[model samples]
Target: MNHVISVINQKGGVGKTTSTINLGCAFANLGQKILIIDLDPQGNASTGVGIENNERENSIYKLLIERNNLQQYVKHTKIENLDIMCANVELSGFETEVAEDKNRAFILKGIMDELRQKNQYNQILIDCPPSLSLLTVMALVASNSVIVPLQTEFFALEGLTQLLKTINRIKMSLNKMLEVEGIVLTMFDKRNKLCAQVEQEARKFFGEQVYETLIPRNIRISEAPSHGLPVIVYDKYCAGSIAYEKLAAEIIEKQKKFNFAA
Candidate 1:
């Protein structure tokens, strides 16, 4: 079965796009067919996977507005089993454009339901914008679960509370099956006492809902997006790359348990 998950965080600069792109690549490397939906107007996920701005003419914006023919919008990334539906600044206007439609929130969900019928991908990851806007609502309504990239910093948990509330609101009214897959602590610095403190607090509060993998504050991860590549592919041996690969394995194992339970 295909799993559709949104890599989401309301606060910006939390490694949300970085986690989405790297995790998609890691899943692909593990022989899973992955489709990354660049729902963020900034299009960082598209650029991270090597989809240039010029190539985003048929982007997620068009897909949401046109509302048909999903395959025509999907573009293959440099990775073998990874694909992406690019997005650009034009997507920022989507909220205003769809204001009159009461069913606007289900637009992406309809597209996702169609994709599931095709069964072309093992995993679909949506890179949500850094805000609790209409786009984020659409993604939350479409996804089966969410993977939150919680930055290890002051007020991290405070920001997470708002996001969790939003998810709960969506689950109650929009998507009944919506759940948090796991919380990934990003940009962790082991030597920093605050980072360790944040991790302990997160594990204590969320317990098993937080993953074991901690993505370190590595320069390699920050540099990979400029090179239009995932850190795992740019430098396979880097600390960031190893962490993402391990996270992917952990996610897969969790999925197996979920499937068995189902």
Candidate 2:
């Protein structure tokens, strides 16, 4: 069975792309076939995995908008059992293009159904844009679960309310089985008293919805994308790599519980 997850945050700079790449890589290393869909128009996920946007012809944009074939667009990453669907600047136009189609909410789900029928991937991860646009909505519709990443800042919980509301709306209207995977606290600095305060407040509000693994702020994480690699691949000993590996374990445990309960 495939677990399709969308890493989403309406507020950017919360390490969404970093989490996506690291989880994909870690899963692949564990011998699972993984596919990362770069839904963000910025294409950071593509570059983070060492794929150049200019070097590709059929990206996710063409596959979504023109209903083009996905066979050529899917490319293998450096890690074994991991593949990627790169995005380009052209994906920005999908907001207007899929506007009139009522079933636009299910476009991504339709594509995933086709891919699943082919038994291509065991897990599909979507890296979405940092906004409440149609792209994000489509990603939510396509995903069975969503992982929300939050920065431990003062305004961290502000956008979260709206994001949860949107998720609830999507569940009722489009995806009845959608579930929130968990809230991951990212970019945390243990030295900052304010960060600690923010963490306490978030825990008070969200309770068990937050993950046990909190990702610390590390310079290597920010530097990895420029080098076209995930932090785990770029520097396995870095704090970011260690944190993400812990997160991967936590995620796997939760999935096991879900499976057993079923």
Candidate 3:
């Protein structure tokens, strides 16, 4: 399926941007053409994947605000099969600027509709901002499914309960087809007892809704963004990179199973 998956978490520091970058690249390495839309105002995903501030001439801001040709906004990354729609601080003003537009929520959906028809990429990953604002709403409205990164730290599950409620509300009203593909536990530290406890509770409650692959807290993952690259590209042998690779493989296999059943 030519699916659009938004990597989202309302709570910050849950590895949302990190997952979007590394996981998208992992899928690309698996030979799937991928497009990453940096929907975050912070634009961490854009910076993490090597799109410098100077390179972002036609960003998501222009794509949404200017409503020009979407093709011109899509920038091919150094990665072989991955492209990006960059973003920066200018995107923070989009909400106030489009305040009077009655159909603003549907703007992203309309743009994605054209892309879906093209079927140029196997998957499109949207890096949503930390809050459930207009941009996050737009991503949710446009996405077929979401991949939530649940941090294994204290109060992580508490935040997820609220996020799930938000997802349900959006599903019932905005996009009836939207679904949570699965929850991937991130920042897992085996040394921390709390991390393991959190994982156990999540698996017990969510069952198959949580992915088997867990992303450990790694220095390389943090360091990659400084170099404007994904952890997978910076150090393929690192634990964080390996986990994303496994996650990508699992996602492909799971989709194949569902397709066969259908």
Q: lDDT per prediction?
A: 0.94, 0.88, 0.90
Which stretch of 10 consecutive residues in model 3 shows the poorest summed lDDT?
253-262
lDDT of 1: 0.94
Q: For model 2, how big is the CA root-mean-square deviation? A: 1.5
TM-score of 3: 0.97
How many clashing pairs does model 2 include? 0
Regions of candidate 3 where Cα sits further than 4 Å from its true position: 260-262
Q: Candidate 2: which pairs clash?
A: none
Q: lDDT per residue, candidate 1, 1-262, as tens digits?
A: 5689999999999999999999999999999899999999999999999999999999999999998988999999889999999999999999999999999999999999999999999899999999999999999999999999999998899989888999999999989999898999999999999999999999999999899999999999999999999999999999999999999999899878776111
TM-score of every candidate: 0.98, 0.96, 0.97
In model 3, which residue pairs have backbone atoms overlapping below 3 Å? none
Q: Relative to the unseen true structure, what is the Cα RMSD of model 1?
A: 1.2
Q: After superposition, how far is residue 130 of candidate 1 from its true place, in Å?
A: 0.4
RMSD (CA, Å), each prediction:
1.2, 1.5, 1.6
Which candidate should be chosen as best, given lDDT against the real structure?
1
The lDDT-based order of candidates, best leading, equals 1, 3, 2
Q: Judged by lDDT against the true structure, how good is candidate 3?
A: 0.90
